[model samples]
Target: MNTITANQLKTRGVSIIQDNLLKDQELVITVRGKEKFVVMDMKHYNYLRECELDAALHQAKADYQSENYITETVDAHIKRIKQ
Candidate 1:
């Protein structure tokens, strides 16, 4: 992680993105000396998105188990969907 002031990031934004995007490096942008935002590579961003989705699915499964919800077999679920 690297810190860049908001003004410096705005002024030299393109060069900074070009240098860091491929390396999966992140730039922490600050405002009034307080951390405000982060800029990261697309790959890392997508990876984070996937992680969030997985966590949500895991939580859903746990909730279903705790509630004793019945789950149909894969073939039965597919047949019902096709109907």
Candidate 2:
């Protein structure tokens, strides 16, 4: 990871991000000397999102195997949700 201060970002803008990203996959942006944000390319962000979804699917499958879910009618499901 590469780090850039908020002040440097404010003064340098996207050009700074572009330069750092060329050398690294991601960046950490600091605000008031505290790490505040992470910046990554769209490709990496999409990959992360896909991984998150895959983990959720795996958990759901495990839960199903454990008989942890309920089966209800549409109206019952909606009523339960409202409660």
Best by TM-score: 2
Candidate 2 error regions (>4 Å): 78-83
CA shift of 46, model 2, Å: 0.5
Per residue, candidate 1 scores C-alpha lDDT tens digits across 5-77 of: 8887789877876676556567777998999998887887999899999999999999887995657999998
The CA-based lDDT of model 1 is what?
0.82
Residue 46 in candidate 1, Cα distance off native in Å = 0.6
For residue 76, give model 1's deviation from the true position in Å.
28
Clash count in backbone of candidate 2: 0
Give the lDDT of residue 3 in candidate 1: 74
Which pairs of residues have clashing backbones in candidate 2? Answer: none
Maximum-lDDT candidate: 2
In candidate 2, how many Å is residue 75 off?
Answer: 4.4
**Candidate 1, superposed: residue stretches over 4 Å from native:** 21-24, 68-83
